[model samples]
Target: MAPHTRYTRLAEEALSPAHSVIATSQTYDGAAPFPDFPDDDRPAPARSGGERLQVAVTALIVTLPFLALGLAAWLLWGTLIRPTDALLALALYVITGLGVTVGFHRGLTHGGYRAGRPVRIVLAVAGSMSFQGDVIGWVATHRRHHAFTDRPGDPHSPYRYGTHLRGQLRGLAHSHVGWLFRNDPTPVERYAPDLLADRDIRAVSRAFPALCVLTLALPFALGWAIGGTWLHATTALLWAGLVRIALLHHVTWSVNSLCHVVGRRPFRTRRHDRATNLWPLALLSFGESWHNLHHAEPTSARHGVDRGQIDPSAAVIRLLERLGLVRDVRWPSPDRIATHRT
Candidate 1:
């Protein structure tokens, strides 16, 4: 029985030993450490006062460059919006935001679908452009979210505090952007072992900072090549770089905050989770606004499973499938949809 039990638990144990192991250790290496398991389960120490202060201060500092650029745009460009700059920013934002939604969240994090080698590479690069942490880190945090949605261990749940208005506001703030400073990052080995095993994903993740620079710099380079001026490049940097990122950031955070707070709940979700579809954010979030369906069917390839729900991400997936770039997509079926539907 012991040997059979061990073999049965091998896969789950490899992923999260704590969940499979039921025993405890008195002490090891001068501290308590479980034996017979090769994983660590201790909660990482929270940030110190100074570290937290530094993060808050740094967040404040980052706003200055964008503010300065905004001021420049007001004084120099006047009220006239440049078509070229707007187009460039629009293109970049769409490409990069899809990378996070279709690539990082759906593909990498949830295994909702599989992409061919070329598609995988392109998605990875696109996600890198979004300037979120590497693929491994993103997957880790996301898997943690699914594992403990709206619960204590979740990385960014809006219900962490309480149900009062002030508490919800505080929780919303934390889930939006404040948690980055306080929450300990999810361990890649435990949550994203598959990604860590892949050399290409690791390489891309390790080079994330460089990719972010390229994300910002490429627009400027394109602008310079087209308009033949440093000023044009600067404008591209502002519209495409700062504004685009700000837009994506707010929308993504809304999925963590607003999705849980407001909108229509048309699908049944686990108790205590209030994910809903906020229609206004649909286009901006690239079809991610079908929050109720998403929480109800996390790995379904399409979140917008009903009428009047626009899902650009699903369209992209369909295009890729038509191009023979993705296979075995776990699209929602009528039976499954009916089962989970409200």
Candidate 2:
């Protein structure tokens, strides 16, 4: 993490390690360090009235679609999931999933490959559409994750509680989504000094709010043009906009929770990383399921270093490399794979 930007301090302090940092600015907004985790100067700000309203709106957006789908299924014996809706949602999922895995994780956070200006802006904007957070903050939290892994300071480790079933369950919840609401923002300056120096990152960070609206509005417009009706637009908003975002959220969160608790670890990573390969999540997670290898070799472009492990994000990077859109590729080698292989 870079330590250049000065962040604002918060009055109250807590010890929770959160996965998501509050996207207040391109600069790293931090408070004084807590005693629990060293290099833990992250600060989560108090919820403002606008933030509270956004939360309420988000809840409503997620709820109403399910209710409508359920009611239609029960009362009218109708299928709420239309072919177009499914197609749109799937498309959005893949696009935004690549944005997070290929763009945010591999490109920005790990420097698995180097991309040109256009690629960087596109990836950052696409990633922001996933509603994860600003790129700099996301990178900051992720770098912190790599720095700590499953140790005490990890942003969202499933082993934070204990080995017991009760503790595991608590830890899983905390890792999956609980920590997002409960914890404070990470100190970006400490984690992402490189990004702060780039004006490109600052522009993308500032466009976050607009990117969010574009994510939803683009789908709605597509639906309206295709179906030529407000009804189709509504359906698109529900399926492609809200449902896709929520599902991706949980899938990304699952890497923090389920991947840590379940799945097979094929690589010898840092002690106690507990990251694993959940094959079921490979497709949806866009190859992020190869968490063990990711932990073992943080800078490697490809996480699925072995045969038959589908890594879509790596494929994208490979294509971009071929097109000269990305350079300084970090694709894993035979020696690198053997060293990490269990």
Candidate 3:
């Protein structure tokens, strides 16, 4: 099947009432049996050398950026931050952040809008630079999250351990970053078959490792060229490359942890779907902290539908639409928003 056709089919399936039934039926408490997937049905495979290497690599990827904080602080203690490094960090953060919010989450995962081939590819590439994971895997895991929400099948729900205080604390850690270390994997074929069928998307997903290298290398190269010093290059790699990535990482994870556990639920969602509108994280998360409305209407392009809510991702989508780069945007109307309101 054609990529666009598959996308349309998946979008329809996601929005269909039947899909809601499937989601609701899958809901369970912690004691429920493991989800019925091929991976879970079979005996677990022994860890291979490659698997160990992957875990090590994942640890490095997750912690290296965070370690850069200490290095950055040391650098700051010695001298004032270079203007170029700060500016470069800000620019890359915005670009890569929007790439995730608009590209991976809104467009590819939910079909909030349809972009041309080039635009879609560019967005995928940009999002890949954020070091979140390959585009296909990211979409798959997120789709699964939506399918089960805070229930048992969710990949990273803070309520996974139950509603008790200690369980919530443990679940918060699990939802925030601990889940990345788990052996469980979301099946791309089941959750993101549309993306898997797209040649361009597959190409971008394959290029993820290269994009990860480039994301760091670009800052170093630019800093050297701009400042003509190795010191400048080092700082830029630290600030723009690692520190910026770390910041975005935590902010994105906060939407998973904090947004679900604590925040105003002004919009009604599925049973046990405790997504909330976290205003404090609105700007940092590119408006994704408006989780209540998003869960209420998954395909809506504008997450922050109410007044005074700053949705930079939605603004970027609107700009792309006006520039003729994207079409068929699913902007929610007032009536639609009202229907979801508490």
Candidate 4:
């Protein structure tokens, strides 16, 4: 057996009985039941244990080269330290990194803040560099996750399996990258109609592959311009290119795996979800570690609402508002926060 289309199967099994309105299903009548529920019938592909393990092992192996390079760099730091290299790494990291946190996650996925037309396009392009996927695709998948959460339909939830250690480890790996290879993708029409309807956004989404190439190439180009050597270019490519992306991937995925599986859920969510605020990823994930608050109040501009919590993404939104590039901000009120407290 295999999974069929998400809405199709869902409508057939649980739509009318559960609710009068079918948001994802196309069929609608003023006073009649849905006559056509999409038959969620699809072929089930088979894979050997060795083949599955091969995928897991390959993910591990792909990361090793970057780890080795980082170790080597650390070992030779003083001798190899170069001002240009340091600056290059910092610039790329901040630009591309914030592009993911601010642009992809907050702007596209949740609509936490609105950017001006120019900023919106630029952020979309920058986010494409992180190589997650196009803005529309990413938004659709993420919205689906929020809609279903840790329940049966969640695209990636660590709690899908039991809470044992082995289950946790396996679920963690699945949420991190294994879900990408899965056949199912969120139905964009249902989940991301707003993004799909925008022409400029569609243009950027279509250019994603080219943007990914530009992302990897730009660092080396800058390195060669500054250091005037192939060696510097190679090192820049390694550290700011592969290593930067690898680090970002894990940090972003940790929100799905580690945040769900551990940390403190101070706020109440749908009974099924176990969102938590894991402090260590706060800065790296741009205050997205305040996952519990986010799941509790998805559209709110600020996630780090606690006394000492720091949300850089919210800070960026504030700055954008100051510049008049973003408006209709939705900062969470203390009263609202208190209401959601568990």
Q: Which residue pairs collide, candidate 3?
A: none
List CA RMSD, all candidates. Answer: 7.6, 7.7, 2.8, 8.7
Per-residue lDDT of model 1, residues 1-342, tens digit only: 332132223222332324523233222221121231222456556688976875766475346444746665685554665678889989998999999989887777766677866777789889888766677788778776765556545667776566677777788888887677664556778777777867778888988878878988988898898889998888888777777776777788889888988899988876555789999999999999888898888777799988889999998988888888887777999899999877
| Candidate 3 per-residue C-alpha lDDT over 24-102 given as tens digits, one digit per residue, 9 for 90 to 100 | 2344644333343322345456678987887889899999999999888887895888899999999999999999999
Which 10 consecutive residues of model 3 have the lowest summed lDDT? 31-40
Q: What root-mean-square deviation over C-alphas does model 1 reach?
A: 7.6
Give the least accurate 10-residue stretch of model 2, judged by summed lDDT.
Answer: 4-13
Q: Per-prediction TM-score, please?
A: 0.83, 0.82, 0.92, 0.81
Model 4 stretches with alpha carbons more than 4 Å out: 1-81
Best by TM-score: 3
Off by over 4 Å in 3: 1-5, 11-44
Writing each residue's lDDT as its tens digit, candidate 2 over 33-119 gives: 212333434444578897687566655644554465544446335445677877998999888889999988888887777787889
- lDDT at 241, model 1: 78
For model 1, what is the error of residue 248's alpha carbon versus the real structure, in angstroms, after optimal superposition? 0.8
Off by over 4 Å in 2: 1-77
Higher-ranked by TM-score: 3 or 4: 3
Backbone clashes for every candidate come to 0, 8, 0, 0
